[model samples]
Target: MGKSATAATLALAAARTGRSVLLVEVAGRSATAPMFGAEPPGYEEREVYDDADGGSVRCRSITPDDALVEWLSTHGFRRIVRRMARSGLLEVIATATPGVKDLLVLGRIKALEADDDADLIIVDAPAAGHALGFLRAPVGVRDTARTGVLNRQAREVLEMLGDPGRCRVMLVSIPEETPVNELVETSFAVEDEIGLALGPVVINGIVPPLEGLDEPLPSGPPPGVSDVELTEMGAAARLRRERVALQGEQLDRLAERLPLQQLRLPQVFGTTLGPDELRTLSDALLEGVGSLEAWA
Candidate 1:
């Protein structure tokens, strides 16, 4: 599925069962807010929409001030994150490349996602670098301090991440070579260094219809086809077919290496995608890999 698709899945997964969850939009261009129909975006925990039954799916603020303060408070760090913020630490850190911002954000996300009773908490993590910060934060803290509030917080976050029963890392990427390569590289790096379990690799924006492959190839000698036209069309069709086949093969390799669940989403042939599109993506995600309903 696409990022929006994954976000929707995680959101519903959070509310699955009888737990309350927060879909934290901490960083990046588009957070999960768009998936649920929150517009005129702001930085505060607001209920944009609800599950089928209309229960709230909280959209939290992404501003530094809010992220630090709220995260500390909810994660029992009302003072710690605040103190860090006041000391200019959080500010300086937030100003760093996005990945760092993601650590702090995920720490907060973990605060909410970590709730035992909560079904799932989806955080639209920062870019690859920023996300790495969150994924590897535990190692930094665990090796640095013997004891302290930050240390404790880091430890809790680390433990939560390390435990497979609780946390799962979903690496999102396109079927293209670059993104696929990065996904594989990121997976190995995260696992070997952080000892974190990489759950599913979501391959988004898959290409041209493959479910129609055997229906007499769009290439095979068309009725009354000219040699020249047939040659070009056949070549194009063959290339398209090869690309799709390669994506599937690569995806299979990724799944085998990590033994991660693969969620592939078809290319949306739309001029633009908004809430309606997100809803569509969300529906596709839920159609399989069923999880808790957002309002359950």
Candidate 2:
């Protein structure tokens, strides 16, 4: 973990377009702030959003419940649910079933970017496993709710998801066996089931091979090492390189299904970057693409 990282790359990339971005994360353990050098107090949108290169990116986090309830209220949901929370029932209201949580998380992302003031909404979403569940949410809720406010919003979200111009789902994964397998499934699920438009894949923590060493290098360590220490010395680095290979293979498979735009970033440094790293990320993503493209 000696190199600079780009955990908030997507968020910074989206915000660089002069759009008001709603960078959302599902995990209770916050991971996004250090990429930007500071955390907001709970949910407040701090004005001076600085990146590693000393630039600015605005971000906000909303709980899954808040996202849904706010979207409903904004799009005209009945007050019973929104009001009950006001009457001192956060524990009661926020603790809905898992499906309900998924519904709200997506609804918030969809609704927040509707206003003229807002431009982009980058979701850190859940990590590999739950992240797929988060994408499956619209269809899942639509089928189960059947009728009423839940069903209606489910329909709206799903419709938006299907339109390639409105929503784009992207995957972030390290090049490793388990995550690569999960991403393959995610690609299939988004197309066949949830019916979402997908964009390029971001391959995080890619280990760089020595540049310009064209011929395939020898597999073993330097000539002067004992076998035991050689095994230990090479283990971690070997695994890291193996993951980079795994990512390349996964991207090739994913490309057969769709246009796979890939961004490869090295492992993060022990001491995180401030505005400087954010700028590097923003520049990297914008090097080829224009907008974040909510849709394909």
For model 1, where is the 10-residue window of minimal lDDT? 287-296
Tens digits of per-residue lDDT for model 1 on 122-152?
6666567666776776567556655765567
**TM-score per candidate, in order?**
0.72, 0.71
Off by over 4 Å in 1: 1-5, 12-21, 28-30, 54-56, 70-103, 113-118, 208-239, 290-296
Candidate that scores best on lDDT: 1
Clashes of each: 6, 12
Which digits, one per residue and each the tens of the lDDT, describe model 2 over residues 1-296?
11123436766766665545556555554566666777642455554363354445555677765665565566655567656667756445444544767777666666665653445556666665676687777677778778987888778877777887777777766666676666777777877776777777776666666433334434776688766776775675666566667667766765664466666665555565676766765676677465444332
How much lDDT does each candidate structure score? 0.64, 0.63
lDDT of 2 at 270: 54
Flag regions of model 2 displaced more than 4 Å. Answer: 1-7, 17-19, 48-56, 68-98, 211-259, 271-274, 288-296
